[model samples]
Target: MSRNPSPCLVPVSHANGMDLNAQLVLDQKPIRQQQKLRTLTKYIQSYPSGWKKRFELAKLLYQIGQWQQAIDELSYVVRRQPQVIEARLLLGHLWHLTGKEKNAICLYEQTLAWVQDDATRYHITGLIAQCQRRWQTALDSFESAVLKHPDNSVHWLLLGQIQLRLEKPLAAQRSFDRVLSLKPNDVTALIYSYDALLQLHQVKTAEQRLQQAYKNAPSDFRVLLRLASRRCQQHLVLDDERAATLELIRTVLRLAPQSAEAHHLLACCHVFQGERIAGEAVMQRFVEQYPNHPYGWYFYARLLFQLGQVQKAADTIMHCYQKQECDREIYRACCEILPAAGRLKLLQPMLLEMVAAFPMSWSLWVTVGRVWVEKFNNYELGIAHSTRATELAQDQAAAWFAHGRVLMLAEHYAQAIEALEQGYSLGNAGARLQTIAAGWLEECDRHI
Candidate 1:
């Protein structure tokens, strides 16, 4: 027994009657993790068949965000012991996290064959379908899982989410109700039930659910934001209600000091109270704090626009675009601000990128077409984009009008007249649009 010491144990001589447990308790997480990894590596090398040690190492890697390394170790463990359901499940989860959702689905499906427990089998089946975005399949699998294990609140939550995605709000409401019954005051269930109730037009019930969520999770920023938004939307006759709503939003800002959403909400509250200057100051502070947040700049730009500082608003939009932090809203704002500030040609590239990202958005296509035809005099490019817009939204008067305008620019008089007529007949086209279409149609007829 005295011949060799175990590699896994701390040396007893160095212990010196001291408490190793107390020493471990004082050590930092990284130090403790290093010690564990060394011990596990030694054990794994000493025993080649030690799949348990490999699994432990994989979990440690996962905890430290070494996802690819964790996947490697998990791959080994699963290969060595294919029946290890937990390892297989974790491996699938890692694959999903790494954006290899198809791989996760395949692995989970294979593991389903080995899962003997009805609940686990159904759960894994549900996970496979979820990874594929096959909501119906996931719904069926989670429904069976809930039937097999009715007490699992998590399973019920998943079922409810699937039903929501599938647009079966009534079924989602029932599933979320089960989750609430199992764990009363469940914030997720409360929030989701509120959504379901809203979809079902049960306004009173949804209000009650939102109140319950706020009551249960007053400190939660999401609940506070929701409550504050509802209060802001209502016509506040009472000073007390308006003050309370403003205070709720302030609390959110205090909790999440750098949250762009909280800052935006605070600025909007000020604007709602007819305090545009104060709202501008709040948005300025937000952009200063979160210079990289695209929405922060967007909110600031919008405030500047409302204050009649069109040039400054256009500048802010340019800054956001230069940072390569763009989304649909940012692009749309660019299209508006640049044109209003007499920088219409500056929007050409942004419009192209926006259309690529949102190809099905007829408004974006129309914007692209307008820029190309009006600013760059590229009628061919304009016609191509406007044609795609009309194809994507045949019923949209705006889309048809845009197509007709592009055709008129390209000197396709007959096609331009036909498109303008179609748009004028749509009736719901705005007065400005109909007037412009009529003028353009007359111009095209004169040319022909």
Candidate 2:
């Protein structure tokens, strides 16, 4: 029997514009196998109806990276012998590798209908769910697979991964534990288990797991990077721990010199350690190296802001915004710097554009409303933006409070009282905001 073709043989298009067929021709092969392939091609041409010979030719084509030709031959074999399960599976795999996921899924579903084995059925169902990105469905399928074949560590590992994606950290930890039980010292399982622990906020346990992983695989870049990030996130005040964190990050950089994540983390460490000059230099280099990386620019801008270069910081952040790298952090940073720099008038047009772009962002709307009310004294425009903020974030106490304050300033006492009361009822209004709202309400009542 011919060996099953390795999945790694899938052809990848290269940057140099050389086609897969050209690469195949350039590949060196044993002379005997090349001669045999030529002979087999001619033989298959002579006996076109020979399904067995055609299947053999398909496997050979697959081995030699002739994916399209292999798929053609396999399709022919499956057409002639519809019950050939191996050939059907190979063809489906080839279809998946060629990016014909729908066709591959159809074939897998059809095979599942005929397959009596529960394990195979679950595996196929899991594959279909994965193709659709239905994490819950994949989790169900993988769980079923595990129930039928409890010894399969691969199934357990996949189940753990899906559980993690679904944020079922405890369930993922259980699955990873099962995987580790089956395959002791599996590095991937260890890393995933550590992640699950971290998600559960079991920080100490996660640290212990990381130490074990580091001891087991000292040179593993992923383990080193995770350890460094965890340490940095702890915001360690002790000198020794901070020094160790820096050392770990530097080691990761040495191991993977081109790692963007390592550079980002190292820059963050510098900022955390109060080394602003070093942080600025590292962050500048990082953004230059990875201009498309939003976090790089975001952090660099933060360093600039700290160094009192408010204008340059604002410019860097604006660049990030132009690149469509708008997130909560970026928006919040802009809200802080623009107002402090007394550039609210200069930022008004951009804020309006951002509000349009991120209509759901209550913060953006509130910022625009505040600018209109405080900077320009445009009461009508301020009320309009503040009302929109309240509409977008009905549950946000800050939104309601802001709207109510604007209304009171506009001297719409009744509406202001109602808005302030609504803000008070939202239950998260800070003490200062609640007191101000109460004082305003008293003032409104006096007006009434």
Candidate 3:
């Protein structure tokens, strides 16, 4: 009689095949992943009740961004093994990633009930609170997490961030201090602590924290930028601090040679130091290098204006407008600069083009109307454009106020009062506009 075969050796061939398929998935290359999927499908078909194989397949699918397929596989695995906490947690994470936050929260809450470990419970509570934007709840959960897992610097950091959002700067500073105690070279904690200290008006202490952060990450652009800004705000009478500010800006330029922000800050530093020619040169170079960037063009125009080149400034801003870089600041700058250059006519064509391209822009229509009525004394054109603005943006107080002002200027007292009263009723017409409308209403009553 032969000895009974060992139980482990009975399924050695199947075990080796499964191991090979798992290894192929681990390779993570596209071709290997495809091969692994095919092998896993055949393996599952042969052993239809294999939840472990299905879970492995789900992980690989997730790595490849096949979210729905991953979800289906994980769902099957969870149904087959209801006690598999890891699978349920991963399914919940997928739900959160796909923006099904409520589903994720439900799963996480269920998992919290099953988990006995305080650390796991606290982590799940923190995740739920974060999804709800309940900052105080998140802070309490993170505080508990740090208490249970005192070595976790990340928990402390998150707790500090929540405290900051809740406007308890002192509490936030204390939490950041704990993070720094755990990790002295934590640059994020250093920076955040500095901010909290500044909010609390502990200026000297904030400066020390910032210095420590700089020493830890000398080449960090954000740190350099903040340091330079703080120096500028200090308005130092001492030459050393002023020189240090310039050096910080120079270092930023050196570290990020192609950075437009660095160049912008450098130009500003030069201007602040009263080196107008140097500032102009730097700003001009920035605009040349990054012609499509609106800020570079804006700064360059400002430099031209400062240099008394009003016509050049107007031309630069007009070019910006032609490129469709129109914002409130750009419009305001053009209104000021073009008039000063005695070239208000240069902007009329641009404004007309803008309104034609963007017919729904109420503010552009108002600008065109104001330019006509105030700058050129063209009352008929002004009234027509302002009327068009009111039609397009009936709820906009600016449009109503502008129309009322134009009607008042045309000496149409009754119509002006109607428009002005409509604007005043909107309640969000800014203080200046409201004051002018009120005064104009009095004038209209006198005329009536």
Please, what is the TM-score per model? Answer: 0.51, 0.50, 0.40
Candidate 1 worst ten-residue window by lDDT: 18-27
Name the runs in model 2 displaced over 4 angstroms. Answer: 1-116, 236-243, 292-448
lDDT of each: 0.76, 0.74, 0.72
Tens-place lDDT digits, model 1, residues 192-251? 898877655566788899999877766666667677766765745146677777788888
Pitting candidate 1 against candidate 2, the one with the higher TM-score is 1
Order of all candidates by lDDT, from best down to worst?
1, 2, 3
Best-to-worst order by TM-score is: 1, 2, 3
Task: Give the per-residue lDDT of model 2 (tens digit) for 1-448.
Answer: 4221111222333223211211121123446457868989999889878999889889778777677888999999988888787888888877766657788888888877677889768977987887665656888999999999999998899899887765466678899999888976666788889998876556677778788777766666778889887876777624778778888888877765545567767877777777777877887887776666666677777767877889898888778666653666677677677776777765677767767665555656776776677767788888898898888667656677778877877778799888988987877554556677788789888887
Clashing pairs in model 2?
A: none
Candidate 2, residue 94: the lDDT equals: 77
Candidate 3 ranges with C-alpha deviation above 4 Å: 1-116, 236-243, 253-264, 275-448
Alpha-carbon lDDT of model 2: 0.74
Give the winner by lDDT: 1 or 3: 1
Pairs clashing within candidate 3:
none
Clashes of 3: 0
Residue 101 of model 3 has an lDDT of: 72
Candidate 3 worst ten-residue window by lDDT? 4-13
